[model samples]
Target chain A: MRFRGRALKAYVVASLAVLALHYIVPYTVLHRAEGFTLYAFWSILAAAWVVATVVFVSWGWLER
Target chain B: MVRTIAEFLATLVIYIAVGTAIALVSRRFGVKTSSEYFVAGYRLGGFLSSMTYAATTYSAFMMIGLVGFAYATGVGALGFELAYLLATLALLTVLAPRVWLMARERGWVSPTEMLSDLYGTNALGHLVAVLYLVALIPYISAQMIGVGSIFEGLGAGFGTGIAVAAALSLTWVVVAGVWSVASTDAYQGLWMITAALTYVLWVTLFLVPSAGLDIGRVAEAITKAGVSGLGGFWTPTTFTAFTVPWLFFAVTNPQVVQRVFMPANERSLKRLIQYFAIYAIIYTLIVTLVGLTARALTEVGVLGYISNRDLVTPTLLLAAHPALASFIYVSIVAAAISTSNSIVLSVTSSFVRDLYERRAREVRPRRSITLANSVVASLVATSAVVAFLRPGFVVEMSVLSSVILLPLAPVTIAGWVSEGVRGVARYSSLVAVVVGVSTALYSAAAYGPKKAFITTWFGVPISVWVLALSTLIVVAGLLLSRVKPHVGR
Candidate 1:
């Protein structure tokens, strides 16, 4: 249950990256896409970020 | 219309029966102590924990509020909601493990207790409990409003709808505490997702084509709407002001924060996050698509014009097949009830555990359970009265609650990082809550409840000011403390 320094650093970086992409990606790359298309793409990216971070931070325990 | 009414009534009856049965069955799990009653003895499995978490987190706001928001505002609603999801994942990743470990090791029953234990101040716990009660009543009332509006849209008397919604919320939580709430939340969560998916599929495949609409053209129209400044509903200031409070929801809202202590083990907590992420993505996409399609239909004159964004879903349902419409209506009820019960339970737990028992100076589990049940009943009545008065929009009440809760973020984050330093002083926490809440209330009154981002201070939103000011007070208090730092608990 200890908060590992490595995991904490990774989590912070990943969170910032996700937040940045959440704003940047939609406003830039998908700004002109249809509402549904933009929503679908952004949701997929956000969901992937959640999964990736969970896996990365819990790697040791998840592996067990 | 008669057919719709019959379908609605029949579906409602069935939904109540099924939910009651689930609650009754969950009672078999037992609740001999206040902890078991309040938190299901912290033995919830991964699936139940995840389902309850999902159901409680996403409410009638999804179907009634968010759908309309998407239809009216364009893609900004999507970005705003996804921002919340992303922030939630980030917060839960860091906070949930620490919360879980602390709760398990300390046998903490309420979030207020955890804070009090962290800072070593009973007054701090009572202050937080009072803040929770004040902030959460509006939120619980919003759920009631959602239900009442949906029922009224279906031709029921508005008073009847409010009474029915309040009764449904009150029944299960009073019946078996978190046992009933969690189990029923799991059941209703499944129904909500299924109903949403069904409605989206039916709308896309059958309704749109029958109306002679082309999906490609609709997409083009929606995209054009975004490009023409219609999507500017989420201006930079507005977006940051609205989304920032919600992003910290997992840590700020006691209903969800308390769920951090419910998982039976570390593995269960991991699964809870994974399952909720998947459910949230699917639910958000389906709801958003439905909203966008409804907007396109209105543009083409196939659907009637919507004066109020909140009326969009009800109007859309009028065109749906009777059976489908009935199921979706029931799903909205399910969403409202699931969320309302969790809030009622969390608020009641805070009142009973943090205020009542803490003052009684002796632990009496049986009396505490009874007292909590009475508090739930009273709170439900108060919320029903507030909903009948119609204080504000569902989304507005939600955002206001989060704004009131914004100060808690810095305090909680400080608790985790300042392990070697003296914890926040009791007076400091109290002052921060008062200042944050008063500023938020003043802003709400001045700018109106529907406006989430009120730019009162040099173009910055009032919410950001509340956070910054509260953090300064708490940090200053800690640095100014002359007491020696206590070792880690």
Candidate 2:
């Protein structure tokens, strides 16, 4: 009956962090570095979602 | 753009021949019952499920619309698209299992039917079915429009393009329902990704460098272009307005929600989410990079600045080898047809399973399948005509489909998280959805779709307004139900 779990918590935190970075970094630290720097940074962040997806599935968070 | 009519025609003919062969072969698996016809009897393997999901959800928008958006707006388009990818990944992780479990347990075929079951009313299901028709027709038509434009760009005649795309979608879905659609989607998905990878490599290796720029120089040029760089059009308000609706797309879009019901088991569902995420991120990068490369070329004066963003990819095609351009063009056509096929199948299933079956005393599987195929045909014809007409409101409606469908998010979330959400609570939630949709329509009409989406009341975008209003109504209904026992179903 309980829904809370470590993996779920980690997944939520990771997703929120990525979203925060998307909104914040572009206008803040990376604002002036909007060239390849911004592109590389965002690409890596986007790739992180795939890594998160792998972990979420492998760790059974979906089952939880 | 160089007109490669002969090459394009040849590639398109071969693509259709191969796709039709796949669809016809898929019928060997057979579709005898309503469930089998609509959802492949919940027997789609992991690979097929994932591939179909990717193909259906991405659409021509990724290559054509999204590439143009990035070319015109800058790297902000990457953020917008990636946000959608991330949200979809998160939502799939949390909700896919629950939805799949319920579908299997209850023998539900349509998303609306699941909602109707939750509220214990056929009326809500019927209402949602109607809403799907209104919201999705323009979206389907938009796919036809995209195909027509690509055909016109290639010197193939617009009307011929629309008819070809419409005929393919109709034939695919009607052949063996989901089986045929998914089978061909798997083929088309491969073509789409392969074409994308090829195009990106060519641009990065040849196109960019031949323009006297490397990745570094292109990056520098993009950054130097002030308004079209880093955060150009992606202001906080603009980003929020465009992204918030897509964040809930996993649940709000019934076409994808129905996909959640197709995986045969838990492992298939897991694979579905996992594979789709990988495909999505890779495809997302390929698209945005192409757009960025186009923008970079424009910066160096190798390519002219294109006011009409959609023409960016077509213009790029002029520089590509005719063979490569032909492949990419057919791939874009494949994207359109695959998307339209899935939408037609999903929407038809919604109409037949949710609305039609409810009124009949006993369900005849054969009759239901017949009616579903007929509806699929009718919907495709209607969408094709609309695409040909190219009404002003069609684009508005297409743009607003996500916003109009946004109200379904709160209703769906409540159904999933709560038990016995019936009677007045459910009724009030339905009313909330209606109100949200009406608000979206009025704003789009009053201020235009583009402006209406970004326009705000008290600093909140229209998307947020719709979501907040619907959520509030559902909450009030739940509270009212608690206070009065008789109001509970």
Candidate 3:
């Protein structure tokens, strides 16, 4: 954590790779979504968001 | 033309009244300095913050955009409403209060202030600010287009329509600036709520029931119109479509961040969060039911519709409550102005505060800078009219604006908490943004004119994809830094 500078550079590099993937992905791959999967994804994100909120709060108050 | 005239005049009277009342209230409060004008002098608390937050968050996008979206999509549209509810609450609990504390200490009037100060990298701050400027113009332009549409819908004279609306909007904005916007929001918020509820009730109760409209007819018509009519909400793969856009609407949205900052104290924020969630859910359900109802009415030949799918709600209400329709008619105007006023005001203020004042020496006064800011708003407004010549809907443009902001959110959140990633965190955020935007740009054109993207089980909008990739970028940076953490620092 103390030497986050190197870590940031690595992240910058990887993010660029993802951007490349975005471009490489074929348009034909995407299709009309079935609604259930979309709902399920939202359900999961809702859970993750709740968990993240808990983790974020605890991270601040516990050490303080 | 007659319709446009009526709509324009209707908008003018309601919007100017709302604006004047807000300005008058702010004037009476006697805010003596500029600090109070922008951030409510950093002393806003409880009721003022709560009401203003309600007004600020419920933009024209919500009243018109979501209604149109649901009219086209179905129950699946709930993904957006629910996502924003959860996201706003979570943001209020986490980032917002901290931003307040930090701003209280450091006096951050605009978001760019936080970006630069927290990262201690003014270049990164400026880069992000520049993106914000680019992204925000489209969003503001979306608001102006909304105003223009309301005029076109009502049949006002073109010259008077545009000039009157713009003039009234400008008058209220100058009268009290942010204070005026917030104050008018309080009043407009009330009218908009009352009118929305009234129309929802009347449309569902008398209009359809008397005509014997049913669900079967509604489904038949939607099936006939093709996939877009469903907006992919009913697709078996709807969940895939839901995840990214939902989250983006909630947590990653700048407008939501703006709401988090408006509340006066921790208590007010908590109350407002609870307040907004309940209100949002109730409104969503009511409006969706009405949409389904309208579908049946349209199918059964009970009501004749017009050019825009958006006019369904208004038309339904008019059919049901011909006597009381004027109330809701003006109420829709209230809804549009409530949103447009704040958006135009906030965007101009950001340009003024972040771009102009930030550059000015302390003694330069930036007198010309203030006028330049309004001129910039007008110029941007002109460009929106040019863009409108292309035939895209206001909601579509608004969604595009949201998609654009997705790339910037990750870097911002990372920088905000000082995420302890230091150099890696900042760099990752920046990288994520670049990657995200590029992905989105490529994806944007592919998604077609009406929709943005589609995936079967886990559709990620180009915007959401940007945020997700950005997050991955941050994580990878963090992990990589573990191996060699000495370079940037």
TM-score values for chain B across all models: 0.94, 0.96, 0.82
lDDT of 2 at B11: 91
**Docking level of model 3:** incorrect
Instruction: State the lDDT of candidate 3 residue by residue for B66-172, as single tens digits.
Output: 66655666545645465555655544544555665566677666565556666555565566556655555555555556656655555543334345445555655
Q: Pick the candidate with the highest TM-score.
A: 2
Better of 2 and 3 by TM-score: 2
Q: Which lDDT tens digits does candidate 2 get at residues B1-489?
A: 344788888898899899899999999999988899988999999999999999999888888888999888888888889889988898888667777877888988888888888777777788888888888999999999999998887777899999998999999898889999999999999999999999999999999888889878887778766533455577788889999999999999888999999998878888899899999999999999999889888888889999999888888988888889999989999898888889888888878887678778999988998999889989999999999999878877888899999999988877775667765887987898899989998898899886888999999899999999998998788787773322111
**Residue B159 CA error for candidate 2 (Å)?**
0.5
Can you list the residue pairs that collide in candidate 2?
none
Off by over 4 Å in 3: A1-64, B1-15, B31-34, B158-160, B213-233, B236-239, B304-308, B317-323, B363-395, B419-421, B446-449, B455-461, B479-489
Q: Give a tens-digit lDDT track for model 1, residues B10-94.
A: 9999999999999999988988777898877889888999999999999998998888988888767777888888888877776
Q: What TM-scores do the predictions have?
A: 0.93, 0.95, 0.76
Q: Which TM-score value belongs to model 3?
A: 0.76
lDDT of candidate 3 over A1-64, digit per residue (tens): 0212244344345434432322222112222233233333434444444454434333332211
Docking class of 2: acceptable
Q: Distance from true position, residue B488, model 2, in Å?
A: 25
Backbone clashes in candidate 2 total 0
